[model samples]
Target: MDEVVRRDVEHAHGDTRMISALAAPRRTSAGPAVLLLHDAFGLSDDMLRIAHDLARLGFPVLAADVWGDRTLPTTQEEIGPLIGSMVSNRSRWTARLDAALAAAADQPEVDPEQVVALGYCFGGSSALELLRTGGRLRGAVSIHGGLDLLEPDADWSAADPEAHVLVCTGADDPMATAEHRAALESGLRRAGVDWEIDLYSDTRHAFTSPHAKNSPTPDAVAYHPRSAARSWAATTRFLTELFPTVRPVEH
Candidate 1:
């Protein structure tokens, strides 16, 4: 049996206490490592499940904590402040993500050269930010994340030529406006970056997460199983091409 294990890899979350940064469940296979960033929901059970799922795919996943081990926000009102703090100070949070990536690469099972950063909603954007600002990743996958930047937009001329990006976004996602997609498309193209953006019609924000549907804007964020499956399929193909050392296990 390819049993997936979870262990708390020590990573500083801007404090003395060791936070959960690595979750690499190894068997006999190896491919690319995944550095996962959580959404505003803050390292919930759903996030851990994602790590286990990735482990089954023959990939080691390091699900990083954006906020140091803290109680999950009960309401969006609480969530807003948490996310706002990170976005407002992008440099500090991005540094935290950088640290997590370093930890992921240091794992015995992970190939440092083949590490990929992935995120959902807030996490998706965070992954993109890491790559945009010189985080050495083979690829970055963003699932339903708003691409609008609080900082100045990325100068594609400076991007790493080998870095690839996959964006799975809902056509009707209010937060991820068409303007934002257009701008991102323009930048990736101008920079000569290998990137693909898949727009899922009739889908809204957080299509991959059932828990997001309960947010304040229910109409703007609903779970779309079809889109979720499709996006994951795309991600699987993209990652396989980027890191084809191991075959994915049966889902």
Candidate 2:
């Protein structure tokens, strides 16, 4: 597989800021576009690997750095203060996601109408938040994200009724509790949204990452290889089904 160099994208609001993106153009040019959002730890090498893997599946994948040249917190001690301060402020976070999508859609190799958003960890949760604002995304996949079904202002009427959704999470992830999963499913059912949720038994957060390690205590983090592989396969199937034009290309 060929790798494309990272390009500078201007993220806008009142000020213009630049972010790096990795784009892999498809050989056929007829496939859909997939936007890969990295976890809160930021755009590490593993995220780039995932982008390449998705691109090899026949879609033009864009891996965006939502942090946008900013320093990301690495240790567990730093995560709480950083995310806790930013989580509730959806406006700032979703703007970053929106900018990434807008830039991806503008690419010559991308089909704007056939864009799919897939996120990992913090990104996974943000992908769903993007949906709340009524973006042009055709589908969304959340992988082991911290999800809550308590959107008081979610206008189910305005959402794309046919839009597909995939939630691939770990059964043992403390962040994604069974109650929350059930609530999400119930909310989707009530809204008549087309969605599927798969839980991997014994898998913790960030299972897909090879560097995944389990937390020793009840509130720590852990990863499961089996769960990660299975969830990835499920995500591939879901994306292919949603966008029939994109087919998996063996590497």
Candidate 3:
């Protein structure tokens, strides 16, 4: 079995301070490094469990907590407010993401060149920001995350086109309305970025969260076991293709 450990890493070059990262190390000599961004709920035990599972699949995963040590908001109202605030405050949050990626890539067991980023909800939405300047990331995967920014008219035409992107969003999410989805596809197409968007019907916001009864929006329901499992498999396949050193496990 692989080793799972928690790390508190500090960003050396930026204004962003220290953040918590849960690292799961594989048994092999080397593997790809992935920075996992948690949703608005912060770093829950479920996040760490996902990290461990990914590690077992041959990648060393780092699930970073961007909100320092803040507890999860108790209600949907508070959750909405927190998401609003975080999206408006991108510079600060992006810095933390940058730090997490830098730290994850620098680890001894990781292959920096093949680093990737994956996020859920706010974290997933934030992962798109990497595309703005995600040169270091070989690819990025966003699950049930909104692709829009705080500013409706913020231009992002200069993003790198070579980086791969996989986005899974709920079709019923008002936050990810039809217009928003069209805009994202348009932006990516205009930028010539290689990407794919998977829309799941009957799914809502935070579709990956195991506990989300009062999702306010109909799309904010409990996790879809099939969707979550399929997305994870697809992400793992993407990483394997990017970093060929990670061979599939033999049953």
Candidate 4:
């Protein structure tokens, strides 16, 4: 695969503290855009790699940062509190996400009308939240992320008619339990949204992160290459179906 272009950018919400990364296929003209939301770990090399992968598939991508300048938590013990802090300030988090989506759509290389929001872990929930806001998005994809609905009675009446959703998860992931899945399904169904959830067997949380294997709690969160590849394949197909103008690169 060819190298994609990448650059750092700052997105100003009410606080102007978040920094984002933009990546896309080299030498390509304007194309569909993807607002890539990072996991609870915040922006990292793994997330950037995912952006590049999407760019190579003919979609411009922007990796949004939700954690501002806060240092990323390296250990499991620290991750809980860091995530809790963001969860406590859900309004601010949602604002930052909205800003990131706006910034991505405003990019010159992006076709704003054909934008999608794709996220992992905590970001997965953020993607769903974006949908709940009735943003002008073509679709949303959640990869092994939390499935809790922020608004049970959210009004999806203003959502884009073409809006689609895909949730990929590990069946054994304790964080994303059966209860969460059931609740998410009920909400989507009530909203009359088009959605699908693919559960991978024998996979745990963070299956898409190559560095998950190095985590202290490997049993709870480890990389599953097979699951990752399958989920990514599903994403590409979903994107292609949603935006027929952008064809995915054949591997």
- Best to worst by TM-score, what's the order? 1, 4, 2, 3
Query: Mind sharing the TM-score for model 4?
Result: 0.89
Per-model lDDT = 0.80, 0.72, 0.70, 0.81
- Evaluate model 3: give its lDDT: 0.70
Tens digits of per-residue lDDT, candidate 3, 219-239, equal 445666667776777777777
Q: Least accurate stretch of 10 residues (summed lDDT) in model 2?
A: 1-10
lDDT agreement of model 4 with the native: 0.81
Which segments of model 3 are wrong by more than 4 Å? 1-17, 27-30, 77-81, 148-152, 213-219, 248-251
Best by lDDT: 4
Better of 1 and 3 by lDDT: 1
Model 1 alpha-carbon drift over 4 Å, by segment? 16-18, 28-30, 149-152, 214-216, 249-251
Model 3: ten consecutive residues of lowest lDDT: 10-19
Candidate 1 structure quality by residue, lDDT tens digits, 1-251 = 44666787877756623366455554654457898888878778888888887778778888887777644676778988878877888778777788888878777778888888899998998988888777889889999986764243657665577899999999999888888898888878877789999999999999999786666676799888999999999988887888777655554
The residue-level lDDT of candidate 3 at 47 comes to: 79
Q: Pick the candidate with the highest TM-score.
A: 1
Candidate 1 — what's its lDDT? 0.80
Q: Residues 95-210, candidate 4, lDDT per residue (tens digit)?
A: 77888888888778788888899999888988887877677788889999876534445555655646899999999887788887877777777677899999999998989886
How close to the true structure is residue 102 of candidate 4, measured as C-alpha lDDT? 86
